[model samples]
Target: MSSDDDPPESDPSPHVTAVVLAAGRGERLRSELPKPLYSVCGRAMASYVLHALANAGVSRAVVVVPPDGRGRLIEQRLREDAPDLNLCFAVQQEPRGTADAVLAAKGQVHTTQVLVVNGDLPLLSAEQIRPVLCHDHNDAVIATAQVDDPAEMGRIVRDSQGRLVATVEYRDADPAERAIREVNLGLYVFRSDFLWNALEQIVAQTRTGEAYATDAIPCAVRNQSAIAVEVELPDGRLNVETPADAANAEAVIRHRIIDRLLDSGAHIRDRNAVWIDAQASVDEGAVIEPGSHIRGNATIAQGSSIGPNAIIEASTVGRNCNLESCTVRGSVLHDNVEVGPYSTIRPGCTIDSHAHIGTHAELKEAHIGEHVQIGHFSYIGDAEIGARTNIGAGAITCNFDGQSKQRTIIGEDAFIGSDTMLIAPVRIGNRARTGAGAVVNKNVPDGGNAVGHPARLTPSRRAHSTTGDEL
Candidate 1:
């Protein structure tokens, strides 16, 4: 990636356009979601392929989808997920062959060279694609890999003098041919002119009625118009076609994420136990304990300590914050915040700096100010507490009033005794105090005290008027 100060590269370094084949319906997985939309580490499977293309300096891509509701859904989701890439969609009207899928994207790509890859390969990386994109005079550069058990994969055919020849699908290959260790990885970079001509002439298989992209190789070899090269990838294509395949890909992605964090100075207690998603960010000097699952786009800043059993999903944890065995979902914790074990912070909660939330506390849609203390066994939902407030143990914000939820406002420096209940739509003024087991339904004025069931306020230093009064 070029830095902001660096000048962009000029032309002559071929601009390669990409065509992602994602129209297939993976029946083996037994799920209603499209194969390309399958989630691998909380992201769509095809997103990795597009990201790889973007990393390889390909700015534009055409994704081929089936012509149905699934295709429309895939287009919508991918567009929303990948806003960085310039993505265009093409509809494959029929479930023809892979070659036909590329044909569907014919006019969409306007570049001399084109890259074709399967969208189900969640492990696709920029390193594997760079060489193919850089290969200059080849009519077609096909990526191949040597695998232990090349089950149902196409085997790359070579001539007597070890020259590149045809590629045979597994079903069509004989026993001796099937024994070849090297299999087609289904990734190819092709010259646009040669690709268009070859794809036009390729024939469909008799059994499947689908035209294979591999047929283009023989066309190139037979015509002898352009040079075809094979680039063997070190790691084979890790495509997810089944549930087991998805799990394996997820494990690899998880390991990569953790390893990256470890290399970048983050401390991970257990590599195997901690599962951090690809989009999650754990900065240097952060510590992730065992059994922690950081999901979605959560960010843990420097000096933060997360888990021993915590789950943080789509949340942000600021510097020096400590989260124990709890679940923080769609919330934000500012600097120096401390959440005790077993606390559940739901969506729309924002905890300010230096605040401490006690164990077994649940907060939802609450805005907690700086240095606030929420005691154990408290439920602060639909409430806003000002700075330096102390919420007593077993305190409840009775927000739900049978029909609708209401708000509770607690002012700064206020102290509520243990087992106090503040009913909804109530306000406790600054420096106010509530006695133990008080059930407060009306607003308490500043510096006033409430001490009984259906609590009535005692005389205070300040007074409140019936009408709107400026004190």
Candidate 2:
């Protein structure tokens, strides 16, 4: 039962439902966004937990979202990104207690066993979750850790028979309990029926009218139900609820990603060249030069060369593409495409097969067709360039006019001369040619030649258009 698959019922298997508690208003974090939505290693922190759960074969999940606008955003993102994973959202109307949040999702979970997890733990992996689930207990099994200091944490209390008796909070615990080294890490596996019953009893009997999941442990123990403790791997637990903690989490996640990549045979030229949430495939002969950061699920194919200093993110580079000293984000480059010595290929830019972006060129939200050449010191934004076009040095598409951005289209075999400035919302047709130092602000017909500022066609040039040399 992987997180992406349906749970099964058998020995060494259990129909498990995950209840992720994400409703807390992290005052300590001091950010307007919900804590779970905060980024770690270029992805939302909660995504790590979701990935772990999915990998562990726990398919069904109930994310307890806060009763706020952020919760809706979380649901929307989850629907878009992880729709295949059985996801249901329950609202925590207020910051009451962790126990109450789980109770809110009672009706949605059908499995006999439930795994409660913290949404803010970014370092936890699926392997750590299996132990708690496999522990045979009729009542509950909690993941506890042996920390050097148990201050302000719930201390796990055990009986003479080594059964979990109760968890004593730091504020309420006696001196002996406070001295205990083992502390609850707020992860648990519980029988669904027992959990539901315990929640109901706590809500009814407690004077504060707020139920806590921790309070249910004593209730089960008082009834003489079997309760067990499972200690977690020392390095598996991480709490990232504050800015400091978030930084720490980032460092840990970065190191782990680097280790995973190195173990998988990827070379890291420089530790400072960050590869965040990137999936890269380098052929044995490919070289990733220094000062290049590849991030956001990008992939580099075989024989490709990237960076002396470049950045590629959320993009795909085809085989044998040469990307040196350039910055490419949210873009795609096809095979044999060459870019940079100093270039910016911004989001939504696509350079087709065999296209060349020469030195000091910048492109934003543009589409370059195959075999196109964009010369040095050119700015091509909000534009479309057809196949086999040649754009000269200093040619620019003036996309912005202080109010709105407009489009420019250059057709196949079009030649844009040096020092040419193409004002927005213009089109240059196939086989069209613009003379040197031309400022074109209007549409030019196919096979036509235009010259001068706010260019107009030269009549003599039109008659002998075919006689001119290819650009």
Candidate 3:
């Protein structure tokens, strides 16, 4: 079931291939993580660029990764994140420049054209790139953007006719060349045949003697085959090279998501403080309070109110539900469910409609039926509670007895009194009742009443107060 909330991985066309350069190890980010692995708005950096490639009708995507564990990690993530994009991982044997990375994907570059993109541009979107990919006049179209600081980025050089003449690399550019505001953003659409022919001509290396992709553009312009188009991206097409760059990129993405959510009818008390992952869904009329962190594939349906400091990851929240400061991970809550000002619902738990989980209650691998009420300070794990069951405050389902977990089953209309402990592998039948502070270890038959530690079951709904007999 694919929804708009999932990662934007569209089906690619069969005309052109995208060569994504992702082999760099981000030393500036100060983590052992490969640059492409850096997360922005809860998604890897490269996934956004690849999504743009797919959305722009690229035939396939060839991700260039380093040759090691980092490469495998990237490959695995790409496989999961953008499975719809016909993908191939090509290993760049060494940390190299943009030209070398493109060359590495030679095996998959069988199309008439190739779109070269930097993997770190987390703000890249398909709408910002449609024109460049659709340009068919020149042998290649260079993507240029105006930046406040052109530090270390290639400057787009244009001829008198306003056509692209060359891309002057920062390391080799003189004072006049360095003053250009329109700089190459490292995104290009090239004729595949021309690119192959030009790549072989790029023997000139940079100061560190690495093959330079920028150097190829000047020779290409001399052949009158290159044209540069300046496009203004809303987020300025940030190239995330350092930790600060990563932060800026995330800020831009956060604003984008928040604004889109607000426009889509999701209300947030404080948009700046909330962090909703790109893949998470907040339907129309959903109210998200400040300090809410919704991540992964979590979905909050219409009219639902979540958080003041809640964490929901990979969970489904049905319509009109109200959730306070709770942590729900990999759980499902049906319509009208009320969960906590402080509750934890762990993986594999499913609560049916109108179920109420009180403050500080926790549930794990529990199946709760409609109209069920779990009181405060209760722990229901590896359990199944039927419809209309009322679990009193401080109740505990002792599902794990030091060795392994066991099941506790409570039937329909059952009333579990306060502070009761239902031991492992136990069953309380329909309309059953448990006295306060009772510890029931054995099965209580239908309509039975349980009282005292190692509770003894009686025929009546409760024990006789004075006689204390099992009437």
Q: What is the per-residue lDDT of model 3 for residues 1-471, given as tens digits with 9 covering 90 to 100? A: 112232443434466788898998878888777889788888888887877776666658899999988899998987777835788889989766777888889887888878888888888777657668777656788888888878788788777878887788888798999998889887888888878778766744345646755556766687787888788866755688878888889888888888888878888899887999877889988989999999887999999999989999999999999999999999999999999888999999999999999999999999999999999999999999999999999999999889999999999999999999999888888888899999998877668889988898654544332332222
What TM-score does each of the candidates earn? 0.91, 0.88, 0.90
lDDT of predicted model 1? 0.83
CA lDDT of each prediction against the hidden true structure: 0.83, 0.78, 0.83
Ranking according to lDDT, highest score first? 3, 1, 2
Q: Lowest lDDT 10-mer window, candidate 1?
A: 1-10
Q: What does candidate 2's lDDT look like per residue over 174-220, in tens digits?
A: 99899998888777888889999988888777788666888888877
The stretch of ten residues in a row with the least summed lDDT in candidate 3 is 462-471
